[model samples]
Target: AQSVTQLDSHVSVSEGTPVLLRCNYSSSYSPSLFWYVQHPNKGLQLLLKYTSAATLVKGINGFEAEFKKSETSFHLTKPSAHMSDAAEYFCVVSRNTDKLIFGTGTRLQVFP
Candidate 1:
């Protein structure tokens, strides 16, 4: 079985400051990890994904995440945050055709 834990339930950042959302995952086999964001009244958007290929995966909106097998971590990071970046973030994991496992989610609050 695979599962993900979002270390922080909420993260607050000032506009233009860096943003970091921590996530830890457990999987029986190689996992495919993903980060998705959802703004108020909006559908979920794919932020980034990590397959078996590259450890460091980049995605839309200047967001990226690195897969660290050694640490069992796949943390999301952005150099700077925008007011529009405020949303709920989810960490998902899947393994070999299995159903996606989602984290509890982290709410990001960006203040201007």
Candidate 2:
């Protein structure tokens, strides 16, 4: 069974510190992993994806993740948090179609 597990359901960060959203996954194949951000009243936008390639992958808006096969994890990280970063984030495991098995989103609340 291929699925993603987000360690936290919610994260609060001040508008300047770093952001870390932990995610762990289980898969039968060397699956594809994705992090998507959903702002208020908006659909999900891809932040990053690991397709069994690089160990460390970078994506939009100063975000990145390192695929650790041994750990069965791909955790999202950022150097700085922003007010606009307040949103719901989903860790995804996908094979075909954009149809991803999404983790119960981690709601990020940014404090000013």
Q: Give each model a TM-score.
A: 0.97, 0.95
Candidate of highest TM-score: 1
lDDT of each: 0.95, 0.94
Give the alpha carbon lDDT tens digit for every residue of 1-112 in model 1.
Answer: 8899999999999999999999999998899999999898899888998989999999999999999999999999999999989999999999767777899999999999
Residue range 37-97, candidate 2, lDDT tens digits: 9999999899999997888999999999999999999999999999999999999998856
* Backbone clash numbers for all candidates listed: 0, 0
Q: Which ten residues in a row have the lowest lDDT in candidate 1?
A: 94-103
* lDDT of candidate 1 at residue 26, scale 0 to 100: 97
Give the local distance difference test score of model 2. Answer: 0.94
Which pairs clash inside model 2? none
Model 1 spans with C-alpha error above 4 angstroms: none
Candidate 1 residue 76 Cα shift, in angstroms, is 0.2
